[model samples]
Target: MNNWIIITPEGITKSPNDTFYENFQVLGFVTATTKEAALVKLKENYSYINGSGFDEVWIYQLRFSNPNITYLGIEQEEDEFEDDFEREMVHKITCILEENCYTDITYDYFEEDSYFFEAYSDAFQEVRVDVKDETIEVYDRYIAEKHFVHFGDIKL
Candidate 1:
């Protein structure tokens, strides 16, 4: 049974966009004092990607002039202390990412368990649909934790 997670605009076909055709570490505005501050922040740091074939994702932050902290890029992979061969691979991926950076201070990382920052892209096509037609899931991690804490008296 493959667990599925779907994130789409309100009325999408309810398909999971989880499989990445391509991904990049991108950043956009979060909350800036002034519009100028937002622009400056976006100018210094942000995230984006071009192309396809992505399996995992991560999110992180970046620094810019006005000392503004902007959300940047979505990435995959894990570790950081990369070997030479890995470094070369990351460079290739970074090239693609940088080429697609419509924002400032963009970089890429193609390593194991990559660092991803939320608020990466500003492009989303929302899809809205009636929930009754889909098999939706309601999960609560807290409930699971409580179950283990008091395993004897389980309640449905």
Candidate 2:
């Protein structure tokens, strides 16, 4: 079965103070064996149901036909553990620093399989690690100084 989504155009809602606000939101979604069935249901609901606050609604059929993708369905199995590469990188960096006599270590935000970490041994230094690529780079100053940039070339 294919998944379908119904999106409604932006509409205005008047608050008690007569203040109006607009929003574009999803009306609902459904699963059907065919796109025609989903479109029919979407039209029926929008025409005869309590769909009042919107000017227009659109129907989208979710296509999962890409060979490189696999859907996990709606259920997660017990004993299933997802691997977190970023956490592994943090742990590796922490262990390396501890072994090398770097103390007072801490880490900030993990995103896109990368994170910035800092450690002090009478001097402050920051390092960014990309877990997916197994690359580590050092920063000359505190992480706050270069929080916006992701590229650092000094490998460790």
Candidate 3:
């Protein structure tokens, strides 16, 4: 059996205007033959996932070869590595924001974009940075607001 990491948002969806921050929680690790089987095992064993209120969840296969690496068994608390995860995620976001001249960070997640940070220069603007893709998009807040209201669209 292979180990897998299960991740999901902390709670239900929030208002579009609410400040967005990364709050992904690692549900825990499960042993299964495949990713699909791992998810099935998690759903069957963990009641939290059934009522998690999240639209989706992600799973990553855990693979390591370092003989010196310590292994925290599956019985370890779920939050054991949460602080490190949060620090890394926040650092990446902060770097992206700083590199693009965005300060006083107020970030939020759009259903479409997953997560975005907002900052103002002369006028209100919404900045969406896709760290995985190494891409950034900036939009006028007014335009974003209008699009969000009329079309439920935030990506451009």
Per-residue lDDT tens digits for candidate 2, residues 1-156, read 777876766665676569988865665555677767876775564453355655577777766422132444857554222356545666777776666666767676566755666665433457555554445654335422435344343334
TM-score of each: 0.22, 0.33, 0.34
Best candidate, TM-score: 3
Error of 1 at 49 (Å): 27
Deviation of model 3 at 150, angstroms: 56
Per-residue lDDT for 101-130 in model 3, tens only? 555565454344334555543324565544
Each model's lDDT comes to 0.29, 0.58, 0.55
**Global Cα lDDT for candidate 3:** 0.55
Q: What is the lDDT of residue 79 in candidate 1?
A: 53
What is candidate 3's CA lDDT for residue 106?
Answer: 54
Q: How accurate is candidate 2 locally (lDDT)?
A: 0.58
Q: What TM-score does prediction 3 earn?
A: 0.34
- List candidate 2 segments past 4 Å from native: 1-83, 143-156
